[model samples]
Target: MKVTDIVDKLGLTVFSGHEGLGREVTGGYTSDLLSDVMGHAAAGSVWVTIQTHRNVTAIASLKDISAVIITCGEQPGEDTMAQSNEEGVPFLGTTLSTYELTGRLYSLIS
Candidate 1:
């Protein structure tokens, strides 16, 4: 599924990086640790996390992720949004907890 498809399916909010809406989502990865995500997350995966720092966008770009989803209604940092837009990685938002969002995404993509 594409980022746009996942957003529609999960009722996620698109906060930035509109250019990457067509990016394909191969799977989902849920984590708050930057190192864990950097070492484990696969390219084309939608990353679910509570982290909203600018480093999140850096890691997303480095890993070639499809999108970043901020869970539990946490707002992303200004630099994070700017970097996301610059990198063309969609920055999404959700009110659901990390577990709930991961479960929903797993069912949709698996």
Candidate 2:
């Protein structure tokens, strides 16, 4: 499925990086640790996290992540949004907690 599909299915807010909504969703990774994500997240995967900083986008871009879903009603900073737009990595948001959102995403993609 594409990033847009997840956005539609999960009612995710498109915070930025609209250009990458067509990017394929190959898998998912849920983590708040930057190093963990960099070590384990696969390319084209959706990342579920509460992190709202620019480094999240940096890691997502470095790892070729399809999208970053900020959960628990959190919002990304302006720098993060700009980085996401510049990197073409979809930055999404949801009111759901990380656990709930990850469950839904796993069900949707798997």
Among these predictions, the greatest lDDT belongs to 2
**Residue 41 displacement in candidate 1 (angstroms):** 0.7
- Clash count for each candidate, listed in order shown: 0, 0
lDDT of 2 by residue, 1-110 (tens): 99999999999999999999999999999999999999999998999999999999989999999999999999999999998999999999999999999999999999
TM-score of 2: 0.98
Per-candidate TM equals: 0.98, 0.98
Expressed as tens digits, the lDDT of each residue in 40-96 for candidate 1 is 999999999999989999999999999999999998988888988899989999999
Model 2 segments beyond 4 Å from truth?
none
Instruction: Judging by TM-score against the true structure, name the best candidate.
Output: 2
True-vs-predicted CA distance for residue 81, candidate 1, Å: 0.7
